[model samples]
Target chain A: MSVMIDTGNYIAAKAAVMARPAVVPAYPITPQTTLVEGIANYVKTGEFKGEYICVESEHSAMAACIGASATGVRTFTGTSSHGLLLMHEMLHWAALARLPIVMCNINRVVGPGWNIWTDENDSISQRDTGWIQFYCSSNQEIFDTVIQSFKLAEHEKVQLPVMISYNAFILSHTSMPVYVPDQKDVDNFIPKRIPKWKLDVDNPITFGNIILPAAYEKVRKDMQDSQEYAKKLIPEISKEWKKQFGRHHGDLLELYKCEDAGYILLSMGAIGAESKVSIDNLRKEGIKIGLARVRCFRPFPREEVLKLGKQADLIVIDRNISVGMEGAVFTEVKAALYNNSDAKAYGFIAGLGGKDVTFGDIEKMCKKVVNGKAKQLEWFGFEGV
Target chain B: MLSKDLVEIVFHGRGGQGSVTAANLFVAAALKDGNKGVQAFPFFGAERRGAPVRAFARISGDEIHLRSEIYTPDIVIVLDESIMDMVDVLKGLKKNGRILINTTKNPKDFDFSKKYDVATVDATSIALKHEILVGGIPVVNTPILGAVPKIFDRVTLKSIQDTVKDKWKGEQGNKNVKATQDAYDGVEVDF
Candidate 1:
């Protein structure tokens, strides 16, 4: 029923097929190309029954998904940095129209310098786009999260698109053992997309034709309300999923040995996984440090973060920079903790453009935190900052 | 074989030489042997055929949460002997680490750090002997990988054979199995 496989892309593709999406429109990009290619193979081999559309560009890819989603069928798509940026307008269109399309965005650096390496700037820049984001730390998590995204997005209480992301090539190209479930179990988990409103000839409706400013405000408010609803629904669904599948990645944040710790390090994506190793090594050295891996970024996990702030000194590690300011997560955490807690928060920016950030680098950061010599904003693994 | 410590390995080869695939297969084989945690990833900017590339793998007795690139590897597996002339393959290798090179020359002929235990095998010949060629390029990855378990106790030849058989089938699989077994027996290690 389950097998060990290499690459997160293939695992994501397998999960997509098992979810039985009616339509999948995707374009080829570095790192993300293999994901759609695997889907295309499934389609060719007759293992997957979905319509796999090889669109011209990332813009066309999202547009096709939007078109398919409007017809009340389950739709899926995947893209990387520039590809995702190209779908900027359509990203907004899908969210506002309330089409529950699920997409996987491999986090690659946006290029003027032409980099194809891993970075979170691509997805972090889309934080304001109204799409619910889930950052995965492992191949198994990628498979599980992509499968969970469909059920969460399609929930009537939360009809919003979900962007599942992991670092480009780190999880994408990395090989690991992932336990894939049988199709019957997956069917029991995720039901078919049955929308209340759809483009049907018998039941006519108008979508995105014209909206006054006041109506647009209400529509935006409803979207925000659904996001609030999703924050609560995410954990419930994860619990149900765990009850059935025997696995549950913690709701918005996965805390590792943080129950009784003086210092807690916060991170997202692959860096979070690396920090766990750092925490384990640090614990052996008698340092009271732990890791709180942020699973969902769009909802921002305000309560969980505030709870962490109350318990320990928070060290936020960001693979992305807000530019002219500190790291994006640091900025969000600081804003969330304002007037909420007096916990000292330090920001460390690391692994931009695929720079390697190891356990030793993380342990050093923890040591600095322990020494109380950490700056408010520091560039990790950078010398002579 | 189970060890308390994690075994980290770095692979050096050209882009087309299947170093990344070798790394993945190695980890897959380790997982098949019931190792709790395993990870393999490639590090490249703009990869192309004939360009030097690096890939890394880690096999741990416990769950591996570290996703960072391997800095100090326990073993450096060189798939191509020519890459040795281009870069210091021993750069971040541990002082007691082992060097496994796919070369026809003897291990003593090469100048390497005195701390490392060097091993050599004629993987290209084995690949050619097995006629494992992809687009006329002899597939040396499997043969080199086969030599790995011979030198290290972390994985066994049977596990490598089973993984290979699962990956490739029919006559192609048989050829790979034969190449792997031959290389496993032929590898020469100097402590």
Candidate 2:
């Protein structure tokens, strides 16, 4: 039964988290702290089982999570932009060790001059870390994806860390209605599946040992193969999530109204919701436009993304920039559609450092891109006027 | 969209103003009258003193479908006047929505050029009379919550009472309940 309960997004996240259950190891940071507090609170109240480590820093948090997961425990943690940056070095270890850890990344803007708002730069910065990444638009999606992340990560074919990202203040602070499933239902659906290579005291196993150059390529290739396997396994797990939870996730990459449309706007995070409004308004005004929300950014849904650009003029909007280069998403979009002769990709860099990318900005940008006059690396709604 | 209608109100205030506690009171009162409701605070950036924050309440007979921010808020209670200047607080207010401002000054003293109805209450004075701490930041949100049912007659006092009892249980909670009651009794309603 679908019950629409009006809950704070943070509370919903916390409730879903408690139900799924995890041994949390997290440190507090702006925008992302409330989530940490919520999880910590649960641990303190004995509502959730497992050790809650008050780690020194983001790096230690990931390390503690790695330790917990390696020992065959369901582990979880969270961090934001800079904290994710600190955990960068440990991400490689977790992926190499193939620990099926789940993490919540409250996506915030990375800075040259210290700013704490919202952006995808932090998560996008670690695109090559071999962790499966999912971007959530709504609070409900955040709750749903966390449940699915575990299933996807723990699968035999793909045992890797998963990071679910949502814009820090936008979705994190913004209150919303979240439908929480019955705890019994979640347990029946998620059912604890310990991996084959679990750390057992009776049978000791070394994890993340120093690799010699001779065997490094094989180890790297195995990691690569696991990621490729995840590309397929994600759908299988999502299928189960739908049957149990009644939420059909479109694909690794979800396209919104792109069929037969002349122009398409590509985005991730909360911006996708805004783009929907822009698309609807443009449609009313006789403009054929659509939105493509990148649900899974890592183990990138290459084929689906390429196909999205096939029938329409593609405009890629990335909240995170690649410094010196255009937005990282645009580069990936271009790479996806490189061989597709029919598709032309336009890049729209927007919402850096918590700047509110309004529906009006999206409409204006789409108009320019469709007319073939939009500049590459164009910052949406930047004030010059 | 039920026959009675779902009006999701968001109250923006600081930590000490009793915004969250007041919101709980409102939800309690609504639920007592058998109206389904919810009250929740935003994922606070920091619970530091004098920091801007918000809490929400979704009230209706039927379940709520709209999980997003109440973009077109039916009612906006600003406990702190400074919040109005900080953000576009009135951006998506419904045409006929009401804004209750808790301040020491009169309604005319503050700008109300917007088309919606603007009401002001000197909650500081009422709170002072009750010997409620008035030296620090004022607990204007409680009085505002109490006075709101009068402005929006659809909201019953009994519902607020129920929500308060269900949510807030301690002496502090009881004090808030009584404070809300005093606020309800003290509405001047001079428009």
lDDT of 2 by residue, B38-93 (tens): 43435334566677877776677753333334566788888888887786668687
Docking quality of model 2: it rates as incorrect
TM-score of 2: 0.85
User: B31-147, model 1: which lDDT tens digit per residue?
Assistant: 888887898989856789999999999998787788878878999999999998898899989888999999998878777735678999999999999999989999899999889
Q: What TM-score, to 2 decimals, does candidate 1 have?
A: 0.97
**Candidate 2 pairs with clashing backbones:** A177-B67, B28-B159, B28-B163, B29-B159, B29-B160, B29-B161, B29-B163, B30-B159, B30-B160
**lDDT by residue for model 2 over A1-385, one digit each (tens)?**
3434232346544644654545788899887877877776676776777677899999999999888888887888888899999999999889988898888888887877777878888998899898989998776778788877877888777889999998876677654445667777777766786776877889988766788997988978988898888888877777877877778655687677788798888888878866776887888888888888888888877787777777777888888889888898899888888877578788888878877777777778888876667776687766320
- What's the CA error at residue B137 for candidate 2, in Å? 5.4
Candidate 2 shows a clash count of 9
Candidate 1 structure quality by residue, lDDT tens digits, A146-177: 98999999999889999999999889988888
* Candidate No. with top DockQ: 1
True lDDT of residue A188, candidate 2? 72
Best by lDDT: 1
Clashing pairs in 1: none
